[model samples]
Target: MKFQLDEQQGGNAISRHDGQCVWVNGQPHRASLLVPWRGEVQPWPLSRFEDLTEAHFEQILACKPELVVFGSGARIRFARPQLYRSLIQARIGVETMDLGAACRTYNVLASEGRAVLAALLIDPE
Candidate 1:
């Protein structure tokens, strides 16, 4: 007998992750990327979490997701709330976590059919 997992049914899932890279759908992605639950994974120019600004957040907001899962590099980091003021105004939710944790959370949320976007900032080894 076989059990079918929710994430295996055509939804994008994080297949693996490590200190230097993350694998989405079994492909290794070394740089930062924006992974939407139902669309393409786009490259995010900002390499580090500290480089995040209002403009960066605005670009993610343009994707029109109900919530954003922010993977703040190798270790958990918090951003200034003012930087994401537009999201708050738009009533979009943002959750911060380390890259590994964020990846796991994104898989679960996407499997549940939530309109979520994982904004991951990968740090170099």
Candidate 2:
């Protein structure tokens, strides 16, 4: 689906997303990645939700986002707290949802100028 957000001065906003791809700044990306409100979009290097590890959360920790919106592929699946223990310890909030919701939520927070990150896992078809 396509999205229309009041363009913020500078930040990465998700313009569209579907089952297989997500559009960031009008560019389509078909792999798992980390999208911060500002700065370069980095590849997450994860193929599936089942393969998630704490190390993955650690990567996010380094980004220092106030919150993380984790899209668990095509479905809404919650990861175990243990998987993201480090984040909780750091007081960084994390929310999980299906791919579509994650994309939408990320756009909203980003547009509002909040420090948020979208950790999307786009499973291969």
Candidate 3:
């Protein structure tokens, strides 16, 4: 689906998302990715939820976001707290949801100028 928000809001907001792909600032991205409120949109190297590792969460620390929205593919699946213990230690909040919801939530927080990141997992086609 597509999303509408003021372009002037000034942040890396999710512009569209569907079963197959996600668009960041109108650029289509088919792989899993990281969308920060403001900064580069990173490609997350995770293709399956089951393959998640602690190092995945650790990599996010470089962005130092206040919160992270984890999109666990097409369904809402929670990762074990231990996998993200690093984030907990850093006091960064993490929320898990289906891919679509994560996109929407990330957009809202990004538009509000919150330091948020969307760590989305998209299975390879």
Report the C-alpha lDDT of model 2 over 1-125, residue by residue, as the tens digit: 73555566789988889879898888899899999999999999899888999999999999999999999999898999999999999999999999999998998889888999999999964
lDDT of 2 at 68: 99
**Local accuracy by lDDT, each model:** 0.88, 0.92, 0.89
Greater-lDDT candidate between 1 and 3: 3
Candidate 1 regions off by >4 Å? 1-7
Cα misplacement distance, residue 14 of candidate 1 (Å): 0.7
Candidate 2, lDDT over the whole model? 0.92
RMSD of each: 2.2, 2.5, 2.6
Tens digit of lDDT per residue, candidate 3, span 1-125? 73555572668867788867999989999998999898899988898889999989988888999999999989899999999999999999999999999998988888777899999999753
- By TM-score, is 1 or 3 better? 3
lDDT for each residue of candidate 1 in 1-125, tens digit (9 for 90 to 100): 73337345766788889967889888899999999897788888888777889998998999999999999988899999999999999999999999999998998888888999999998773
Candidate 2, position 25, lDDT: 87
Model 3, position 13, has a per-residue lDDT of 68
Q: Which regions of candidate 2 fall more than 4 Å away from where they truly are?
A: 1-6
Backbone clash total, candidate 2: 0
* Backbone clashes (count) for model 1: 0
lDDT of 3: 0.89
